[model samples]
Target chain A: MKAKIHVYLKPGVLDPQGAAVAGALHNMGYDEVASVRQGKLIELDLTGDDVEAARVRVDEMCAKLLSNPVIESYSIELE
Target chain B: MKAKIHVYLKPGVLDPQGAAVAGALHNMGYDEVASVRQGKLIELDLTGDDVEAARVRVDEMCAKLLSNPVIESYSIELE
Candidate 1:
């Protein structure tokens, strides 16, 4: 089984890295770019076959280690 | 318009960050975890409404700035 996780900052949180990207894009003549938000994508290979079980476990992992719950949220996709 | 970009290291590249993550999961009792790869997810807001032009521009951005062509591959989704 494979699990893909996207961990992103919450809406109210400020993202300096994202701001830098946006600024750089604007400098490069991509004036259409209004905003940018950066996040993490983690792809994991697991031994399990049950999608439900994998989803539950991966969600727990996100809460415990993969993401900072105070400022970030994560979504999990299992296949 | 909104664009979502996923940038990841090409397969066969040594990802120390991912290896550390996998090791951490193992230490946390996630024995089912076989391997892990870490990447970037970037979301951008644009002023334009043309999906085709946005896609082309975003693809160029990935090639020129968002990702390293030598070691990374990127995919773009426009909405």
Candidate 2:
């Protein structure tokens, strides 16, 4: 099984890296870019076969180590 | 318009960050985790409403700034 996780800052959180990217885009003349927010994508190769069990375990992984719950939220997709 | 881009290392490219993450997971006793790869997710808020033109411009952004074409590949989603 494979798990694809997207971890992103929660609403109301400030993202300095994202702000830098937006500023760069503006300097590069991509004026259409209004804002940018950066996040993380983590792909995991796992040994399990059961989708349900994998989903549960992966969710646990996100809460335990993959994300900072106070500031970031994560979503997981398993295949 | 909103654009979501995922940028990742190309296959066969060495990823030290990913290796470190896998090592951490193993140390934390996630034995089912076989391997892990880390990537970037960038969300952009744009001023334009035309999806087609936004796609083209975003692709250009990826080629020129968002990703390193030699060792990284990117996928874009518009909403």
> How far out, in Å, is residue B61 in model 1?
0.9
lDDT string, candidate 1, A6-71, tens digits: 999999899999999999999999999999999999999999698888888998899999999999
The C-alpha interface RMSD of every prediction is: 0.6, 0.7
Per-residue lDDT tens digits for candidate 2, residues A1-79, read 8999999999999999999999989999999999999999999999969999889888988999899999999999998
Error of 2 at A36 (Å): 0.5
lDDT of 1 by residue, B1-79 (tens): 9999999999999999999999999999999999999999999999979999889999989999999999999999888
Q: Give the alpha-carbon lDDT of every model.
A: 0.95, 0.95
- Displacement of residue B79 (Cα, Å) in model 1 is 0.5
Candidate 1, superposed: residue stretches over 4 Å from native: none
**TM-score (C-alpha, index-matched) for candidate 1:** 0.98
Runs off by more than 4 Å, candidate 2: none
Q: Spell out the clash pairs found in candidate 2.
A: none
Report, in order, each candidate's fnat.
0.93, 0.93
